[model samples]
Target chain A: MAGMRLQIIGCHSATPRLLARPSAQVLEIGNSPVLIDCGEGTQMELRRLRLKFTRIEHIFISHLHGDHFFGLPGLISTFRLLGRERPLHIYGPKGIKEAITLLLKLGESWINYPLHFHELEQGTSDTLLEAKGFTVKTFPLKHRVPTQGFLFRELPGLRKLKPEVAESHGISRAYYLKIKQGADAIAADGRTIPNAVLTEPPAATGSYAYCSDTAFDPELPGHIRGVHTLYHEATFLHTEAALAAKTGHSTALEAGKIARAAEVNRLILGHFSSRYNSLDSFRKEAQQEFLNTELAADGKVFDWAEL
Target chain B: MAGMRLQIIGCHSATPRLLARPSAQVLEIGNSPVLIDCGEGTQMELRRLRLKFTRIEHIFISHLHGDHFFGLPGLISTFRLLGRERPLHIYGPKGIKEAITLLLKLGESWINYPLHFHELEQGTSDTLLEAKGFTVKTFPLKHRVPTQGFLFRELPGLRKLKPEVAESHGISRAYYLKIKQGADAIAADGRTIPNAVLTEPPAATGSYAYCSDTAFDPELPGHIRGVHTLYHEATFLHTEAALAAKTGHSTALEAGKIARAAEVNRLILGHFSSRYNSLDSFRKEAQQEFLNTELAADGKVFDWAEL
Candidate 1:
């Protein structure tokens, strides 16, 4: 199986604090890098993590909140300064293109690289990016402003080889690729060997769902059903449920309920409110509803291979 | 001396690095905080330093470069999030207001505090602010864009009272205020006492000049002549003089020459190019021409009292 890793760059809600940062993350699936969000100070976090700048060709922004996409202009300018010539693709809500372009125009600067923007609608879910055996889809999210959640689904891995069975069937090495592709192999002797008999089944497809800055909505589980890993925002504690609802944010308990209802294997809670000094409470609150809960700390990496 | 302290936040040129940051500094003159040229990630540095955010009422922006002004909108939003109601005044170039306003509008967010912008002219030198025994003036700097440098000059301090001299002259205590105001005092016996006899000289007026992203121009010295301390941009070493000139930046040797010609008491070199690792070389090169040269290291504070 190709490795899938999620690197949490910043997950604090509202504003950035001394220890806590705004929302941002990097999802690496099938060796392809995708940036989930670009908050203010996100570039610094990217530099601190020592991630390959050129590898992140695609950036997905959830909304136009200053904390969500304020770093785009700066990051784009930095790329030009670093002499990047590759095209950078941005998938975000409408009005993002105008916002970014306005800032560039005001600065009297233009990026050297080609920037392609894919504006998503708030009413419907749609596939945003498909490349490298991975497909990314955007689903509507309930927030004060127009927001969307991302779902990353990995394609099926190559079939495992049953070497002993293949040799017993006298299948030539040339037919190995066809067997991995789930095709029946034809031997030189004009014999038909079923693909299942020649190779073992492929590994289960790995999928991840990211829902941030959204309120507690029961409809979310249907769109992200049975995701292997889910990252949901827990912007408040259970005691502040009213505040969370008012702000269109999810409490830790609500995030747990959503994750459990979706039947995700592992749930990662992030986008914590700065009011809480300790994150242990968030994990504990989430674990009460969902047994397998993980706290998304800054610079934390969740590697699917290790899991 | 009013205990002027210069706080270096980020001084690296162009993009921010893992350890180094872009250009930003806080000048505490006469116990009043003034922010100069806030670059991206500067607010985090301010929080890391534990500065009193409310004390920074006035901010000066050198130019519209993304690094210098990208942090303004976030900082403003953060102030609002933290429940700041005080007026925040910003002095910058003509397009600063439009640039900042557009970003705020895009986010659909508004600040709670009164934000006042004092846009400076490109070809004019004028006093922007005056209060608390200090006056701030902007002078044009030679850059690729319409950039300006700031000069902070302290007004004359309160006259110092010589107790022994006053007692020797038999000056009444009620006459002290008049004598301290540089007025002659009349004794109860109708004898005139000169103010010089009753009081000693006050401390020298402290001044600081900030020049960044500027080319080495001879005319700069005329505007910043004899300033107590000058912080000039040393973006390159003498070997890369041509590159520095092409980029509208000054080399360490050029900064030293400017400081020497301006007859400034002390020179603090900053806005360094990230290509060079050892800053000691910058100091050494500047000291060759201006002996009182200092390097503007991150988190380094230059206190006039210590000097």
Candidate 2:
């Protein structure tokens, strides 16, 4: 429960194939569901998975591609119709606000809740959010348009409290929080009690990186190095490497190479081109360079440290 | 084959709930499938029904409401991805081209096929298209936004040819088309055969009209009078007639009056508010004034004269 879980709602590239959705996923980190890239049919898919739409508070978009951004307007409008009161924050490339608000103006369906848009225009990585127990950072991606790869890392949690130890030291209940924060406690006799002797160590945190619609960039590995799981776009196979580069996409082998370079614990490849009949080849090919590689599909879920 | 078939892809109003889709339909007339009002899940519905998306050449949009037009950009982008070569024609309210093209430009997913937009700005009724065996016309509607109601009427076909009559008359094979066009046939001896003697009467054609998100306007029935099937929005019941009028939506009772005044063969009530638990009340209320009324639901199909 303390780890991260990435649920792939859709992972296809270019367009939405029969049942293969475009780019959209629910990354649950720190017990919060963050939406990434809302393509067409995302709302239906969210409903299909029975995930509460209201739980998605923050949305991270990778780029301005239609497959990634086409569903934003509909989802935003649906939120208003559902009488959403909580503020919705959208982080993506510039011009998202204008494009989405224009349709709202035309329909006269302005939202009742606060709608915040954080437009990213820089070509460098920046920390975007610091939430309860995790932080979200964006790194630059090489694409035809402005793109950002999101990295979610959990923060170190507080140390567990030892009630017996605290009682033996005659420590008051008010000082328990300070002891869990690694601070020494002052006992009833005004003597200092070492926190190391009282409480256990905090649980290790996990990290997951999501990079899509990007070409093979050697520098990308540096931003997501040593992540527990890295989701990289493998839009084409090794046979179409040239076309993949020309279109600012990566082949399965190239994505594997990036995973190997980053030394990530596991690799999950997605955003596959619909031209391929079966996705088995993607995993087989990526595993050549990164042994712990898995193919992403609709409704596929990956918990932390699971290949 | 000679009659029209109206397949309701989605008929609920406002947001797309559980399995209820928003406003979208496929009206097949004269053997060609014409798309009407593409909502959020229209493409998925089309795929679910195994309807060939390419067969949809002409798309009619009643208004700029999100439920009616939000899916256009995704559908257009998909057409390009699917390698659609033929041109796509879209008829809707003004500013549709600008709204849709803006997204296309942002995504850089310009369609390879020629996409022509017919934006209607005026509030006057006018014929928009005259195709193979049917003609499409738009009529003004009372709504918060600039909305248009579409009427599709079948054109007269060639008279049926009687092979036995033509053989006995000794008419030339090359003159069969002429005889079918109601021309008299001439025998080898210069004797003329009356057209009625050589050909049978042509089969009758059925017409369908689509109207949604409109208030109760007495003048609307005159525009689509005597249609075989009139699909009107019945967003609320008579109990909420005041609320319906305020929202620029028609109640079931009001829609029934319009159908009765228009003297349509059948009435299909759609666009019901999601607040209602059962749609039976809408059909029952509409049937009070127009006994031939029926309720429209997701995936509901109405054949000509089925009511």
lDDT of 2 by residue, A68-123 (tens): 98888989998988889999999999889889888998888889999999999747
Please state the CAPRI-style docking class of candidate 1. medium
Judged by DockQ, which candidate is best? 2
lDDT of 2 by residue, B225-270 (tens): 8888899999999999999999999999999999999999889999
Overall lDDT per candidate, in order of appearance: 0.88, 0.89
TM-score of model 1 vs. true structure: 0.96
Q: Where does candidate 1 chain B have its weakest 10-residue lDDT segment? A: B99-108
Model 1, C-alpha of B243: deviation from truth (Å): 0.6
Q: After best superposition, candidate 1 residue A121: deviation in angstroms?
A: 2.2
* Model 2 TM-score on a 0 to 1 scale: 0.95
Model 2 residue pairs with clashes: none
- TM-score of every model versus the real structure: 0.96, 0.95
Compute the lDDT of residue A304 as modeled in candidate 2.
Answer: 73
